[model samples]
Structure formats: C-alpha cells, structure tokens
Target: MDSVQFPLSTGTYSINGRKYRRTAYQMKVATDDVAQKFEQFEDTPDVYDDEPSAGCLAPPGLPALKKKIAKAKEVKEAKPESNSTEPTEDERISVIGGKKWIASISVPACFIGKLHGMNRRALNALENDTQCRVKTPRRDENKPCEISSIVSLECVQRCLDRIEIFVDDAKKTARVTHFVALPCDQHEVQENFEVFKQLVLDSEHFDASCKNPQLFTKSARLHLTLSVVCLFDDVDLQRITEAFKVIEGEIKEILNNKPMIADIQGIDMMNDDPSQVSVIYAKVSGEKIQEVANHLNRRLIELGFAKNEGGDEVKLHMTLMNARYVAQAEKLKKFTFDAKKILEDLKESYFGTFQLTEICLCPLNSNSSSEKFYDKLAIMRLA
Candidate 1:
C-alpha cells in the first residue's frame, strides 16, 4: 500500500461539506498503497474508518524503504557542492554510527536569555522557603484543555514509575530524566512573573493550611514536554539517535521545509484529576507542534528505544511550576501551592509568538547547575 504524508496547516479546513478545526502544524499520514500503486485508482479517496493506533508497529518493508531512500540521497549528495554563499546555510544532518541522529531545535536567543534571567530570579526565590497551594477555578471560569492525556495503563505506569525513581532523591538535586520537548521563551509575557511568584510565596493555599510551598520551577528550565521516556541512559540515547536517523527523511518530510513560527501564548492548568498541585504552564498551539511530537515519539517506541506516554498527541506548553520538589525536599519536602489560583488570573492572558530555529536531542534534567538546561546530544535545523 502507498502512504502519503503532509503538513496540516492551522485553520478551519472544509471537506465533504464538513468543517474541522486544527490549531498547530501537525503531520498527517494515510496509506492506500493499493490505490496509490495504480494510476487509475489515484483519484479515489481511501477513507479509514479506524486508523491504526499510534502504538502499533510499523508495517513491513519500512527498514528497506529507509535504506533505499538513504542510498538515493547518498547518490544525490555524491554530485557535491555548489559552494555558493547560499549553499553554506545547508548543514548536513549529523550521523552517528553511520546514521542520522534525532535532535531538537532552539527558541530565539533573546527569549532564552530572558528565561535565564528569570531562572536567576527563580533560584534566588529558593532562598526563602515559601509554601503555597492551588485554588481550583470555578468550573465555569476556565477554558478547555489544549493538550489531552491518554489514560492507558502503559502511560500511567510509565509516569508513576518515573516519579518513583525521583521520589527517592527529592532531597538531593533531581536528575528526573528522559523526556521529549520543545523549547520556548516566555519572558515577554512573564515579565512580572517574579512578582507574581512573590504573591504565590505569600498567598494562602487551597485545601492546606501549611505556610511552606513546593519548590518553584526554574524559568530557564522551561520547555513543552513532548514525551517522558521514564528511564534512559547513555545507551538509550545511542539507540534512540540511530533509530531517529533511520527515519530522518520522514521527519524532514513532516516538517515540509516549514519554518517554526509558533504562537505560544496563554496560561493554563494541567492535572490528572482533583489534587493539590495543579501543573501551571504557558499554552502552546498548532499541528506542526503536535505532529512533530507524535512522529518522534511514535518512531522511538516502534524502535524499542522508548515507550509511549499514554497517548500520541502532546499538549504543548512551557511548564512554569509544579510541586515536584515538595516530596523531595530535605526539610520542606512537601509544601503546598495554589497553582490553580495563580493560573486563574493569567489563564487567558496572551504571551506572544516564538520563532523556533533548531531541534536538539536534550538529556532531560541531566544538566548540572553550571550547564544550560539543554544538554544537546544531537542538533538539527529546518531549512
């Protein structure tokens, strides 16, 4: 069967007299090899009543197809260089063990610098152990969720298992490892976040009377987590990188030479259910964002390099805070914070647009205090 893939732009698109909405740029893959193989059947639309779930393994011949494409690409590269000035902009995708590696991109520099500055402020705030909690917004006041969670046993187990690993080390610096994400700079919208944080430090927490709050998220460490691999090591990175190289063409195709100018505005709350610490994050929108996340995550799972984080789609957001440190603190391991109250005030407020440059394969929370949050193992840029 033949499959066609393409980028779905953000907008309301009409088909079969029906209108559908999509937010970010997303990858769409459909297979009708029987029809695509024959020119006479090309015009016919092949509808899938139930498409294969994201967790399913790739159909046979995928590896051979990858090798064929790589061979063809190699032949094309053999023709070699037009060293013209414009040609310099094209940097070949990095290869490891003779394979392309999976990588992530970066946000604009000015935005990242602002995030670092905010991180410094966040770090300074740590000096004062202020306790807080989330006040639930009246159900009517909040908007619908931008990102959805898949409630599969696999997902639940994966997240909980990872949490368990870190739960033991809450006192020391956490190396809560292995997650896929997109970087974004939100300082422009969060200019007064430091003050807002102060309010959180002094505010009353819902459901808890404790004066101590959970540890705050470092602004510099902000990212829209795509998938959590749960447990990963150097060997895992090696396996993941080669697996990514095999599908490099498809990844590029999904990107469709599109530049990453994303609208990462708004604040929102994400949580599993009614609990104490609601995850507060700046909202991210678009199909490209979701598709890229699904593509990378699904591919890795298929290769046995990683596992699914419940569902395929990623709800994009740069997480601002959670009580991650609460249970791990040596002295204040369990401080409560009213993340819901803070989110209620900023939830609909616009942040701004961000221009994404490259994608780097970052080791999750593996950086030292002196290092940048992204310890890139491999890097790639869009044309």
Candidate 2:
C-alpha cells in the first residue's frame, strides 16, 4: 500500500451528483474535502415501505471524523465572537471649582457727609455699629470680618501664605508674594477673581472733590443743574390759563370727596399715599400739536384729568413742576441762596408755555466751579 493511502488520509467522504478525475496534489486537499472525506460506501437492498428515511452513513473512522468536524464548527463560530468584545477599563470623574465673588467699589462720601453735617453722633454710631457687625469679630473665630476688612485680610493672607512679609525699606510698600499651589497647575482660580476685582475698582462711581466748598452746606451746589419753567407769549399764556381752569373744575369735583389732608413738611396738601411714584414727561414738536392733544386725550380717560364730562383730552402743561430739589441738604443755612424759597418761586411762576424743541437727558456729576450746579456727562438729543 502507498504511504498516501495509509490512515494519514483515511477520512469518510460523500459523493455528489458527479465525480471528476483529480491530480495527486488535489487528492491530498481537494476542493470538496468535506464531502469526499465523509462519503458513505455501504450497500443496502430497496424495501417496499413508503416512509421517508435519513441518508446512510459509513463506519470508517466516522467517530474521530465527527469530532474533528465539530471542532472546526466551533472555531468558525469563535472568530466573530472574539471580535465583538469591548474594552474593560474603569472611567474617571473630574471636579470643577466654584464661581468667584464680586462687589462694586465707591467712597463713603454722601453717607459720611450726611452724618457729619447734621452732627448726628447716633448716625455715626449707627454707621460704625453697622460696620462693626462685620468688623472686629471674635478673634477666636480665626476668620476675617467686615467686607472691607475681609478684602484687606485677603491681601495680607496672600503675603503670609507665601512667607513674603518683607516690606520695601525705601518705597515703604509691601513686598510681592508668590505661592505655588500644588493641585492648581496654572492659578486659574485666583486669576479669574483678580479680573473681576479689577473691573469693580475701575467702574464709574459718585465721587466728591474736597476742594469744592458747596458740596455739603445748604449752599451745596451740584455739578449738574436742571432748570424747568413754562415759556409762552401773552397770547399763548391765555390758552394755558384757560386749560388750567378747565382742569381746576374737575379737581374741584374730585376735592368734593373731602380727601384727607396732611402737613407735609409744614405745607398742607392732599395726599393719595401712592405706593410708588413715576415722573412722566411727554415732549411733542409744534407740528405734532394735534397728535399731542390726541395722546393727552387718551391719558385723561385713564386718569380722568379732563373736564367737559365726556371729552377725553386733558390740559397740556409745559412745566411739570416749578422747582425740584434733587439732593438733601443737612445745613441749609450755609448756602448763599435759599434753595427752598428758590424752588417754591420757580414752581409758582411756572406756566405751561414753552415750545418743545428738544428733550435732553443729562447726568449730574458734582458741583461745578463756575455755576455751582451739577455738571452734565453728555447731552442726548431726543430723536
């Protein structure tokens, strides 16, 4: 027997519809290796039974061959199973710090002046007491106190933390401090807060110039000055007077209800006890007089500021009030002129006659040197 025909190639095979002559190399590993290896070679006689049956089998090394076939089937199934596995490492968690605190900065000029002008020791005591609530706290707490004190303490703490307490001998300024926080690679936390602090330090705030003499007394003049008065010719003045009379009639009717009167600053006046007050000023061009009348008519319906019963229009007044006091003065006697009297006279003389040319929005800074009035920041002309 040939060596190739030995048990080395002794495997069962099955035949299909046809057979082909094959070369010696092809016989070793043929294209239809499974069918050739599992071909059955047993003989059997036909029976008359009409029942269907499974295919016949060969007994030549069939047990060992079935084991090899089953092993190959398992390997084929495992290729995709191994490829479908996922990674098995643990994920991580990260932490983010909190937001930085911010506060605006302004000098205690107004509040401090109010305390000093009235000689109110209690006010000072109150102010100091309020400040002390946050200051001079129990040292045992070992914590910073007061807003300002905390800011100052933070500066000192920074220096101490870095162990840089050397003060400059010539300049008399505190030494610079540096700290290397181990967890924070880049000082991003402190840098963010520093940016916020700088913004507050650079913001625009009310300031007082000590060189100005009129800032605190009754004569205390502000930098910005506002003047409002009724302007009209003798003819237009008649129209205003007539309109005033018309509104006065309605006011008299409203007064019939007998509203409560109060001594407001020694001046008797009707009080509505309004919860909130809003100042409204409507400016119209001369060409828009009809439109202005229509607008006022709607306003009168809402507030009933008109007479003639069903008419919706209200009286048009140029001046809202004669004189207005924007700032409170503790020492009125110190002013050169009587501000109260000036305001009263200005109010009494006010008659709605001024032509609406432009509306100005101004900012009051402080008392100006030339006019002793509040200065304007920038005038915006109404479009």
Candidate with the greatest TM-score versus the true structure: 1
Candidate 1: tens digits of C-alpha lDDT, residues 1-383: 79898644445668899995433322335448564332231222324324653445575577998999999999989976443222111131122232212112222222222322465453223222222111212234332111111222233233333333433343123333566666653575345444545565776643342134445565556566766653333445666666556655676788787766667666666664434554666777765867877787787667654555467765677766665555566555554455555556556655567666555566655655622456666555544
Candidate 2 residue lDDT tens string, 101-193? 111122122122332336655434543543321122232333322222123323323322221112112112212111100011123322432
Number of the top-ranking candidate, with lDDT as the measure: 1
Candidate 2, residue 94: lDDT: 13
Query: In candidate 2, residue 3 scores what lDDT?
Result: 50
For candidate 2, the per-residue lDDT at 355 reads: 26
| Model 1 weakest 10-residue run by lDDT | 127-136
> How well does each candidate superpose onto the true structure, as a TM-score?
0.46, 0.18
**Which 10 successive residues of model 2 have the least lDDT summed?**
176-185
Off by over 4 Å in 2: 1-108, 115-120, 127-316, 319-357, 362-377
